[model samples]
Target: MSDQHQASASVSAARALPQLGAWVPGYVLRIAYAVTAAIAALLQFPLGSWLYLALLVALVGALRPRTLAPWFFLAMTGLSMLWAPPNTHSAAFFALLALGHLTHVFAARMLAVPARARLQLRSLARPLLHFAVIQATTQLLAVLVAVLLPGSSGASAVPLIGVIAALALLALAFVLITPLLRHERRDERR
Candidate 1:
């Protein structure tokens, strides 16, 4: 980044939203969701192997969301095996999911956004909240519907519940960050 752009980005970040350590924007959560979807899709038996290979390629090269999405769905067709899946495998599953989500955010910020160097985390607050609410609502409804459906054993449901809980907590923490920073700034003024 040029010195001029760097200067402007800090200014924009300061103006747009509060910083959370490194000025990570709220929309990072959207990237997180996109990544999570890919990972969830990858948790399959045969298809997962391909998605994993694709992820490696994307990491070394550029990632176009369009290119990767179809594979995610294709791999996701294998998810039927999860309906009565075992809980013993959840730890690795959730770990990979989180990693995938973080990787997407990192890729978007570092590679896709040309002006990323000047972008502030604070600028994304409103949109982040808006999308987050939508994601949460739909996710909750899915959970409810899944519960209503037959053949949805507790073992399979538990992992999904855990994934939802983890994501919710992460988003909640990020949501709280903006207000907390604002309050801190106010206190500093006083």
Candidate 2:
């Protein structure tokens, strides 16, 4: 065939292939969640048998972010915290925080939008800002806590403080996100 004819034929063949734009984002997010979960699990229990269970949970959660699987995965990770050895390194802790938050955010996004829907980067600005704010606040609090109580003797209060911090973060999230959600609902009704 002539070059132009061959080029057109190849273009037509490419067009015949299934469009995978939708599948790409969904699967990429799912895989990212699973990988983050696995890493978080490894961070918590480096050499334990529970790693397998965590991996399974992560896979399930990644597959069904709209269901309770994500919650189950979070709960499993939380439980691991109770028995895991103390980690004094702030960097590792921050990494864990980021991983958990990103996993949750990914799951929430999957739940909120259809996999086939196109998302604009501008739509992510607000959420990204919120995430930054949360991370910054948490990191500041962590530094303060570390500075105020610099020994293992004060470690007992760490868990309590963590729970309180989590509750506060949840409240902050609700306050920050509820208005947007309500607006979306109203738009849908309209």
Candidate 3:
């Protein structure tokens, strides 16, 4: 191919791929679902008919494409929270969140890429690491506050306190991630 033809083809190939931030909405929505689930677990909500609703929404989320998937996934996750056991266990809640995080990270590429492309394990690793780090960091902070501030409230305050701390940490993460997101966008434009 001629030089001009080669340059044009390369540009088209680059345009076909999405930037990193393209997956941000899906990732954030999934994290929101996980946080909501944790809050529900801490509250120890009784399992009810909502379990079925969760299943149906999750099915819809899995079947749909692009932005709809995250919304449906969020709905499913929110519904699932209402079905938490009456005595929610921390280990179970964390495990559930871990599973959900992996699901979301894997879905990112599928959601962003319409055309068939080589999906590498390395490409998926970054998002998984980023999400786990965010959740683990907030969880530690929440535990610290929960342990130290016993006088804040009785046992009933666990959910409220943890949610507040986690939300604050999430807000901070968004702020910090902004520059990284912009950098990704700039690279995509080049």
On lDDT, the leading prediction is: 2
Residue pairs clashing in model 2 are: none
Cα lDDT listed for each candidate: 0.51, 0.73, 0.54
Q: lDDT at 25 for candidate 2?
A: 45
Predicted structure with the largest TM-score when compared to the true one: 2
**Candidates sorted on TM-score, descending:** 2, 3, 1
Backbone clash count for every predicted candidate, in the order shown: 2, 0, 0
Q: Show where candidate 3 strays beyond 4 Å.
A: 1-48, 75-89, 142-155, 162-190
Error of 1 at 165 (Å): 23
**lDDT tens digits by residue: candidate 3, 1-190:** 8999999999999889654442333344434444443443333333555544454445444445455654565545544543332122355445555555555654565566443344444565788689879779755654555466546422355556546756998999999999999999999999
TM-score of 2: 0.68
Candidate 2 lDDT by residue in tens digits, 100-142: 7777777777676565565544555687788889888877776
Q: Rank the candidates by lDDT, best first.
A: 2, 3, 1
Model 1 spans > 4 angstroms off: 1-48, 57-112, 153-190
The candidate, 2 or 3, that scores higher on lDDT is 2
For model 3, name the residue pairs that clash.
Answer: none
lDDT tens digits, residues 98-142, model 1? 444444444444444442244466655655565467556644554
